[model samples]
Target: MKGKNKHNKLKPIMKKSMLAALSLGIALPVAGSLPHALAGAIEPTINISRPVLNDDIYWLSHSSEQVDALPIMPSMPIGVDNNTIIIDLSTHFSSDRFTQLGAISENTNVARAYVTNDNKLVVVPYRSGKINIQLQAKNALSPEGEMIRDNIELYISKKGDLNGDDKVDSADAVQLYNYLRNMVTRRGFSYVEKNQADVDRNGEPELADMNALLSGYANQSLGAKDNSYVLTFKQVDDAPYALNGKLNGDLKVGATLTSNIEFFDPDGDTPRSMLYQWYRGSEASGEGKTEIIGATEAVYKITAAEQEKYLFLQVTPQSYSSDRPQGNPVVLRSESTVAVKQEDIVSLSPSNGSTEVKTNAPLVITYNRPVKINMNSFSSIIIRNLTSNQIEANYIFFLGNNFRANDNKVIIDNPGLKYGANYSIEVSNDAIIAADPDDNAYMQGTVVEQNGVQWTFTTQIPQ
Candidate 1:
C-alpha cells in the first residue's frame, strides 16, 4: 500500500495454529496455552517475558483496584463542576456503561467520569453480553475498594418511562413484560430478540425496576414544574494570569472534589436553567474579590499561570441573586507519586494496557513520586519493539511537554508498536526540559507495581 497509513488501525487476526494452555485456562492458539478443543486458532505469541505481573503490585493506582475490570454505565453528562447540585443516578440501572444497542460514549475522558460545568457527562463506555454502558468515572473498581465503595451508592438511572404517561411509573414492568411478549427491549433487529431478549437476561426491569420508578416518581420535587436535566461542569482556567500568580484557586481532587458553578437556561418543560458561573478570586496581596461569569465548555490548562490550582468562586450563568452560592477553588498539584524511575517505558503507542495513544497524543510519563524537574528539550518520545533485546525502528514521535489549554494530560502519537508484540515506551524527561541539550532533566522516579498500570489492551479497527 504505497501512500496508505501502514498503521491504519491494525486489527490483528489471531490466525489459528493449535490449542493454547494457561494457568487460568485461557488457551491461545499460538501464544497462550489452555486445554480445549482445537479450532486451531493461533495468536501472535508476545513472548514478553512476563513484565512483572503482580497485578496490583505493578503500576497505576486505578489499575491496582481493577477499576476497568467490568462494563460501564451510559446516560451521563461527562463534566459537572457546578457548586449547588451534584446529580444522583442510583434510582435505575446498576451500572453506567451498558452493553446494549443504545449505549453512548464521550470522545474525551472515561472510567472515572466527571460532570463538566456545561452539564454533559464525559466517560469511557464499555460493553458486555449484549448491552453496552459508559464507565461513569475515569476508572472502574470492584465493590471492595474503599474509595470506590464510598461513591458506589451514587448515580441513578435515567431510562424509566414505563406508563407512556411522559413520566416514570410503578408499572413499567408491564411495559417490559409487554415488550418481552412482542416488542423487543434490546432495540435489535427482528432476529435480535432471539439473542438479546430477557429469557434470562441479568435483572431485566424486574421488581428492582418497579421499586426505582416508585421511589423517583413518589418524590414530590420531581413533579414540580421545570424538569431538571443533567448538566456538565468544566474547568475554565486558561484566562491569562500574572507571573507567579494563581491560575484558579485551591481545588481539592478527593472526596470533596469540587466544580465551579455554571447554569443552563431552562427551556420548555425543562426546569431550572443550566447557566451559571463561579466566583473568581485573586491571591495577590490582600486581593479578595469574587464575581459570577460564564464557564468554559471543557477543562483548560494554565501553562503560564504559576503553581496553583484555581477553582470557580461563583457561577452566574443565571441572573444574579444574593441567595446564589459560589464554588470552591482548586490548587493543582501532582496528586500521585511518580513511582516509575527513569524513562523505563513510554510505549510510543499501544504497548501495554494503554489503548488510546495517538501519533500526536501528549507525552504522558508516569513517575513514582511527583516530579519537579523541567522537560522542555527532548524533541519527543519514541516507541520501539524489542526483538532479541534490541531496540528496533518500530515508531517515533516528537511529543515534548507542550501544555494545551483544554487538556488534563498529554498523549504521544505513533510511537510505532509491532502488531501483536510487546514494546517499551521511552521518554527522555531531561529532553523535555533540556534547555541546552546537555542538561537533560532526567528525574529519579519510582516504578509503580503491575497493578498500578494497565499493561495490555486489545485494539479495534477505526470504524
Candidate 2:
C-alpha cells in the first residue's frame, strides 16, 4: 500500500446553495448539507447526514420522521455523474462494516464509513489521532441515541491494504494475518466482527490462525522498511494510572502517530535512566521493539507508512531480572490503523472563561479529553484563600488524569475546602499537562471560587 497523506478538510457551502431543495417539506438529517462530489485523486468520499438532533435514536440517521443509517451513508461516492465515491461492502463479503475513532475524547464520537462523492470510491482515513478535548469531562455530550450515531464516525484508512495487493481483500489470507498481528489478547476478534480467516472457523482466532499469520509472511528480514514501524504503550488501567497502564503497538505513519510511543522509564517512578522506546503488545504479555530512548524530547518520530501493523514494549517485570526468566509478556493493541504524532490531548476546559465567578457555588471545571497528571507534571497552581484575599492554603491535592465529567460538572478528588467559606481557586497559567506516559495534552487545571453565602434552598441556622 503506497502511503497516503491526510489533512482535515471541510465542506459547508453546498448545503446553502441547495437551501431550496432542502426545504421540500420533509424532516431530514442535516438538511443543510448540499451534494458535493469532488473528483480529486484519492479523495475520501464522505456520507454526511446530520441526524435530527433531539428526536431520532442517536445512532440512526433520520430523514424528517425516520432513522436511517444506511441512507445516511455518503450520498456521493466518486465522480461528476452524481457519483463521487461508491461503496460495495457486499462485494467484499456483503456484510456491512463501519469504523469510528475518537481517541481524544471517549465522550466525542468520530465515525466514518465508505461514503462516496463521485463515481470513484473514496477511502477516507481520519487524521484525528486525538481530538482537542480536556483530560476531564465537562458537559460531555448526551449518551442517548445520538451516541450510537456518533459511533458511526469511526474511520478507516486509504492504506489499509493488508494483502499488499493494493486492495482490501476479503478472500485473501492477509486480512487474517493483519488481524492476528493486531491481536493483543487470546480472545482475538472478540470485540470486533468475524473475519474470513477464522482458520479453525471457531469464530475465535487461535494459534493455528496465528501460524497462518506467520505463513502470510510472518517474520521477515528487518530493514529500512521497519523504520516507519513503531510500538505504543497506552496506560489502560481501566483506570488511567501509569502502574496500571497497558502497552501496545502499531506502525508509525506520520508525526500524528505519537499515541503509539511512550517513555518506559525503567524504574519510571525515578526519572534517571529514563527509557523512551517503541513498545508493543498488551501489558499482560507482550514485548518492546527497541531500547528505551533516554532523552528529554518526550516525542520521537517513526518514519513509516500509516499501515495496519502491530508492535509492543518490553519491560523487565519486577519478578524477573536479566539473569532470571520470571516474567511474562504484556501485550496490548492500538486503535487499528490509528496512530498519533503527539499524545492525543484534545484541550483543557475554560479555554476562555470569565475572570470571576459566583462565590456561593464552587467553580467546576472540566476537559474535552481525559488527562494523566502527577505530582510534578502539573503546570499550574491550585489553592484556597479567604475571599478578602488573606488566608491562603494549598490543599496539596494531586489530581492525576482520568477525571470524568458530565452535565457541565466535573469531579474533583478534594473540593478540599470548608463549605460556606470564601475561597478563590485558581488554575495555574500552564496548569494543563499529560501525566501518564500514555496520556495526551487534554487536561487543564481550573480555578474555582466559593463564598460564605448560603443557598436559598438551605435553611439558615439561628444566629
lDDT per prediction?
0.27, 0.28
TM-score of each: 0.17, 0.20
Q: Write the per-residue lDDT of candidate 2 for residues 1-463, one digit (tens) a residue.
A: 1111111121222323333322433312231232211112332332221111111112212121222334223211111112121222222111222222122334333222243222122323222121222111111222221111111122111111223232222323335544544443333332112222333323334335434323322222111111111100111111111122243323343222232322221111222222234443333233333332442222433332223334433322222122222223232334443343332323322222222333333334554444433345344334444544543434332554433344323443334344344444455423444333443333433432222221111111223
Off by over 4 Å in 1: 1-281, 284-295, 298-310, 317-366, 369-380, 383-463
What is the Cα-based lDDT of residue 130 in candidate 1? 20
User: Which has the greatest lDDT?
Assistant: 2
Residues 72-94, candidate 1, lDDT per residue (tens digit)? 22222112232122223331112
Candidate 1, residue 91: Cα displacement in angstroms equals 20
Query: In model 2, how many backbone clashes occur?
Result: 105
Could you tell me how far off, in angstroms, the CA of residue 350 lies in candidate 2 after the best superposition? 7.7
